[model samples]
Target: MNEVAVVKNQILDVEISDLINNGMGLVKINGYPIFVKNALPEEKVQIKITEVKKTYALAEVLVIYQTNPYRVTPKCKIYDQCGGCNLQHLSYKYQLMMKTNFVKEALVRIGKLDVKVNDCIGMQDCWKYRNKTQVPFGVRNNKVIAGFYKENTHEIINMDTCEIQDALADEIVNYMKFLAQKYSIPIYNETEHKGNLRHIIIRKAHVTKEYMVTLVTKEDKLKNENKIIDDLVNKFPQIKSIVQNINPQKTNTILGDKQKVLYGDEYIIDYIGDVKFAISSKSFYQVNPIQTKVLYDQVLKYAELTGNETVIDAYCGIGTIGLYLAQKAKAIYGVEIVSDAIKDAKLNAKLNNFNNAHYEVGKAEDIIKKWQKENIKADLIIVDPPRKGCDSSLLDTIKTMKIPHMIYVSCDPATLARDLNILSDTFNIIEVQPVDMFPHTSHVETVVLMSRK
Candidate 1:
């Protein structure tokens, strides 16, 4: 086999059962349930081991011994390599079912939370629904390549078409490709690091039906970009803003310190229900707008906010959730560590005229500790920490504050469960709901509601 190393483990054939984290079908392998990244339950498959860990070893599906009746071929040509979308091969219904069960499993097994989890809020259109995408630019085979990095590696998989992104995004990539060919703008090389092009951040306004392109890099090769943008605007007609984020950092971070507008407005406004949000390339926003609306609606329902109650939104990135929940509460306090995000939150609140929503830029734990010193009370607190979950100190501070109601929005169930377990000591989890914010990917966005015991 082309000198590829092979290790044989005589794993017993077990019924394809249960999806563990990362879209793997968990089955007993030598009395231990292991995750197989590309497999679903009910499919008989052979796994090739890659790494052995203490609890679970990572493996890839080598062959499908027998395909499940539910198995459907993935529609995307680059589905396997793109890494953005998992479960792209699975049916939409199956995606919803697994995502719903994922939340239930986390709550019941880890948190010991005897809570009723509602069915996952699924999307109407599973394909090409993402509103925003960040495509990296790399050079390979003497050609500039703009696409997502391979699943876990820095190597860019040269691509012009991606099914998960809005079909227009692919078209825009193609347009950029043509523009590069005509203008001879060199593609950024990761190894050589000498190209003007670095990344492309594309966002489409749902309300205005307008698109904005944020070209991210240190140098701009598209001289007279205003004319180019005007040409693009004339052609596309729907494009509102074309901007360049001049970032030279050799990291994966999006947006640069300096931003220059090439055409039209500086920022495109996005609307979620009655509130309008101004989004920039630097601002953090949920990629899936439709599902995020559903997720926020679920949050609103669970929060049961009254105009007289005070609420605190922890880790409030750009204050979207707090802004969404602001009108219903008397006073909404948003705490964010990122100064830029806090600035965005305040701007968003002011833009939407949510006079009651106030934001402060500081770490959550520090804010909670200080607020506790002043005897600040919140009827509700929303915590949406990163995937690693909240730190123990933050959790301890949260406990110390003794907020009456807590809403935890998590992207990782394992961490969510771990945090919930600690929180369960003083709070009783009342509701658990999973929202498929990222369709196709193994990732899940879940919200847990807790009330003080």
Candidate 2:
């Protein structure tokens, strides 16, 4: 430990010892932990303390005296300023290693379970894997700006291309910005609570090569809408759906309740492992279709369906995982809180002719408790909860039902470990698999298999 006094706005030299869960580099100055962004482990750097706290201090790296061997040059020019991807500076191989360790560490430290965690499933070509793009529209220096938000700020970093998103989506966004400028469209200002255009969201299907363009605006109407639509349709022949989402509120939420089809259909079609799905403007589809298949396939393998088992897919969004498993299971009951998602799930089930599959719109925990009282039983349960992980009530319901097996899909490793700890008494951890759903980000998705003890 160095004898330097730790104070706010003080510049000090430090050695990065480790990386935290959010991809920030960790260094200690005078026996106090300091977190520095854009720094790497095993590197000596000079940092300026931005804030001083009792537990830990936050700092920004000023200079690197020694660099890590695994550090690489990020492809995106705005990678340092954009909040999209954090691990873009780290080598791809090291990113995979860190993610694999993330799962193992969570299981050991939080779950208190010493289990085998397999190496993370990585992409062959990590760039341009995202199938969706949501670019915020704004104005800077009297010019239309559209791109991602700056790190920890609402300011947009105007970008013509993004290494992670599909190239066509970037092109569409640039074109939208160009048209907004050409028509002199007013850009929404959050502070003033005025203007019309807000965001431009683009979605693409890999197998079908179809595209959906959704223009999110502050009002229900758009200026020069017909011309913009005609231009977009003529330029992109693959565009299947063009829609407008009206978000009149002054809040930060992107999509509003009302959506209108400006041209073409209201929804686009896509497939995931032979299961066709109709994706609407508000549908919750995985951004990475390639890794989603890998994640879901692991879920199916862990499910071990025998053609006679009844399974409950909790928090089933659009019935993607449930419909995939419906091929081998006797029956599938999917539960979701979103009514629109439930409707889409039912439509997908009907389209696929999976009469044995059923979907209900309700809180997953409440529905599970109701089913328990009604004497309905499930041989296995698959839960793909949000980053917060499974609710306590749902975990209790799972314990009460004593399902023979469970497949837990989690985006946040810490939450997954916490939930696994809560159910450790009832279930035994069999194995864990970490999937690199977002290649250049600190986030890692994991799938766990647990069997009744």
Top candidate when judged by lDDT against the true structure? 2
Q: Tell me the tens digit of each residue's lDDT in model 2 across 1-453.
A: 445447889998889998887999998756778889999999999999998877888899999999999999999999989999999999999999999988999989998988899999999999999999998899989999999889889888999999999999899999989999999889999889899999999999877889999999888879999999999999998899999999999887899999999999988999998999899989999999999999999999989888998999999999999999999999999999999999999999998999899888999999988888988789999999999999999999999897899999999999999999999999999989999999989999999999989
Off by over 4 Å in 1: 1-15, 32-34, 50-56, 139-143, 220-224
lDDT of 1 at 373: 88
Clashing residue pairs in candidate 2 are: none
Model 1 pairs in collision: 86-440, 86-441
Candidate 1: Cα lDDT at 331: 88
- The models' CA-based lDDT, in order, is 0.80, 0.92
Model 1, global lDDT: 0.80
Q: Which ten residues in a row have the lowest lDDT in candidate 2?
A: 1-10
